[model samples]
Target: MAGARGAAALERDDPRRYGVNALETLLEGLVDYAGLFPPAALPMDDAVRNYAAYRVGERRGMLARFVLPVARLDEFVRAASRIDRGGDIGPWPLSVLAGPIDASVVAAFNREHGARWVIDSIEAKATTVGEVNAVAAAYGGLIVYVEIPVDADPAELVHAIGAAHLRAKIRTGGVTPEAFPAPAAVLRFLAECVQRQVPFKATAGLHHPLRGEYPLTYAPDAERGTMYGFLNVFLAATLLHAGTEPASLVELLEERDPAAIVADAHGISWRGLHASAAQVAQARSRFAGSFGSCSFEEPVQDLAALRLLPPRL
Candidate 1:
């Protein structure tokens, strides 16, 4: 009898063969937990419990971060006290939302928790260049992500984020039809980030594995809205970062057919062009970061249902 090796152990010697290796290459540690936000807005207690469970669950390989609001830091710590954790789970890495990137505050929290938590990133809303600069100045070392308004001119703001050596953030979609940015806008934001060499993370609304019209909420009568599939956005990003002409990117982002995506160790193809897993991984590491979602199960389950992820045991 032997313990199971994780996703990292599924690599291929050739690095060009498809299957588990390629899937791992594409999805290794992707989703970030934002269960406190709208639609599924789980309470601090419930969200913390879900995060702790997922960190040790079978789908843990797909988990990347826990998004906690700045205002709820106290609540999170208090709720986290009741969840029993083993040594194997490690410190819960967090992306604190709406907080000043003050190292001392984070230090105090870490000091109190005895290595149960570590905060290395902060997500702040910035609608202008000056605002972005203002937030970037507050933190000296932590990765500060400034969420830019997609409706405004993101070029200058994105440039500022890059110049300030900070990361960019976007609200990819939300609970309403209007919450989702248009394909052109998303493509614009991603292209600008690539042009400016700024890394970014997406929050809210993206839960499906492919682009399609899905219910906006857990409510039965919730109106369906077109949501950007994580695959469409990330794959388009890989191509954009690799210097592929982005004219087709608009269509790529708007693409819905799961059959349109063909992936292997060599690379993944949407339509006719290809982007290697290493190239995509580089884009993920250096440019596009993890996306925030309320349900960890939805995206993983969707990917599995689509045959993108290996079937459950």
Candidate 2:
């Protein structure tokens, strides 16, 4: 495919943009392998219909999942109620996005639908970690995921989230690649999550599959009144955690070679992403029996399949 030329182009680009502080030339060669495949983006929306439509459009790729963020439990219930009544869309898995303050909502949702709720810790109150942990423990069987800021001390977050039987996810924004976490740090976090047996997910600023510096855009949401792509957060984190070294990670980000990273197989080695299909199935089965089992779906299934889980089944 565009592997060779893409690699060369990446070498010419600035590796700093991809969040690696390593030898540029080495990073380029390492990233070349990632050029063989592509990355997928989840549909972004605040409206139920829009999210449903996004899921419908995501059937074409492996990473077409959907996440819904709510500020309150009432909002989540209202939205879930609407989705339940809106009729089935397809096979996409729908996760309810909530933060530390939304624990009551998560509890309420779990009570109503069990594992149908995915607790999200987006922009949460750090000071209330104990409260969040309590809620997470209360709903131990549900999919509890937390979003750690780029600057947040992941060690503590990981421990706190894990103790509560919740997964920890790293959150990012469109800052310079230099500001992104180190590959070693990302790997350590992933490894820790696996060791702790917690599954995590990423969100926002990951529109493209590969790593690269783009002219940051300011697409603000009218409702939330927030701008998008402020720091290229997703791309940087993907590069670091995509099962590669600092060099290759930087190369992919500099070149924006989504295809390369996906094909490398070794490059995108997230715990769930690279696990054997059987293993993934087992994980899903295990999750199904946990407090987070309501939204359990096979991780080995492509993103499209995962996204379609709630709607199709």
Candidate 3:
């Protein structure tokens, strides 16, 4: 589970300039940049530079907040200072990992450097109502997401999260096959969240556009795992919200053929099921929040290959 604290939308690519489409609606502000995390665990300076470059790139529409841990805020400040050439660079938005840190830590960081950047949201882990309530009390007034364990039934914890008026989070995948939760587990989590009207963001092992077996790491011969595609996950949420049955959702979650899904100006369709541009936009802006990804380029490149996105953008 990962989270950051604070509220308000980040500065992202203006979709109007490109003319909004179903695919664009489905994906805008859909990726929270997590370059500092595993697999592509980059050094601070490199990750900072990469995020800086992506903020102004064409596909910035799909980008969201920069995910950083509170412990490394000082390191981030120092590294970010090096690339602090003004212009359209920063005043960057951030989603901080709230690990054993108080909201005061983020408050202090913002007090000193709020003008250049802001930590608007936070991610934290919780398994019980006490932990969920504790996180809410500690970080009240900011957007908070509690990551719950899907390995076991998360209904109780999901209820706690919804009752608290907070959001939900799920770990879709990690570096190993063991890290990926079963499709049934994912479906149940999504179902519970939607039933409770809890919005969610996903993290880990979702850099690709479609589900398939892929290397767990960047090493020469990393172990392979069946990864859940971001499109599969997000679209499943969209369709689930539209009242698609649980069984169909499981199939959608495990969909592999790029041909099985279609995206065009009207909206995106999978099998015979379709969601119009408005429905896609509503689902994304409301229920299906973004997923965290280590590399922004991977999803973009994959989408381009599927011809869902232009090669240039």
Candidate 4:
């Protein structure tokens, strides 16, 4: 849901930009801040502080999980305790990055910490179908997103993931041009997930809101690549799952024109078709889940530059 406070702020600043209200709803809790990851790989203290600030600020509504590796739960716990002000900032929900799931560490940490830190999700890599299934069964109630190989036939792994009732994960972009898969490959992955009724989340190289050529790293002279837009990926996924015009997907994923993607009070419109907020909400709830970014502010600032997040917000 869109935050009432944010809408009210926008209403006062420039009432006309309130259409951004609808756009804001489209991204509510849509990004899992991965400040622990590449590019803007801040230290645990810095990431924890930034997350705490965001959790209590205006854009808090847009904030999702604080992403960190499972191994550093203690580091986060220590850093967070000093800054969190005893729940004033957060009992932040987290999505742990791990390989070969053994959630006991996470479960034990949460149990002894007055539940101040809850590791409710795991994003793990899977090499074989059995590994995927084993992870699914091991996590019990914790939400598990299995990142499988998108290079070869992903059907069997996707099928197994779907059957086990775990969300699928996709690596949409990366540190190098070669790290990002072809647009068609991504589309195939999303289509298969949708076709299989399996929900998915995206990660990596999606710092910007729209797909365009961008730097692969934070270095001053970093190499550039064609990065997919978080907006394009999510919108394409939702529209595809809704059984909208199937052929439009390629263009949708590759669309660099932010103007081509618009949101009115009614819903999100791209090119020519529309997806009702209800439908997009459904997609967010069940089909296409959230993406991870190292800097939450980068995405929000991009939206602001596009006037999708006006001064009021």
Residues 220-284 of candidate 2 have per-residue lDDT tens digits of: 42112121221122233333333334444333233332233221211222322332222322332
What CA root-mean-square deviation does each model show from the true structure?
Answer: 3.8, 13.9, 3.8, 4.7
Residue 81 lDDT in model 4? 78
1 or 2, which is superior by lDDT? 1
lDDT (C-alpha, whole model) for all candidates: 0.78, 0.36, 0.82, 0.79
User: What order do you get sorting by lDDT, best first?
Assistant: 3, 4, 1, 2
TM-score of 1: 0.90
Per-residue lDDT of model 3, residues 117-191, tens digit only:
888778999988889988877876677888989989998899988888888999999998899999999999999
> What lDDT does model 2 reach?
0.36
Candidate whose lDDT is highest: 3
The Cα error of candidate 2 at residue 179, in Å, is 7.2
Instruction: Kindly report which residue pairs in candidate 1 clash with one another.
Output: 18-265
Residue 19, model 3: Cα distance from true site in angstroms = 6.1
Worst lDDT 10-window in candidate 4:
4-13
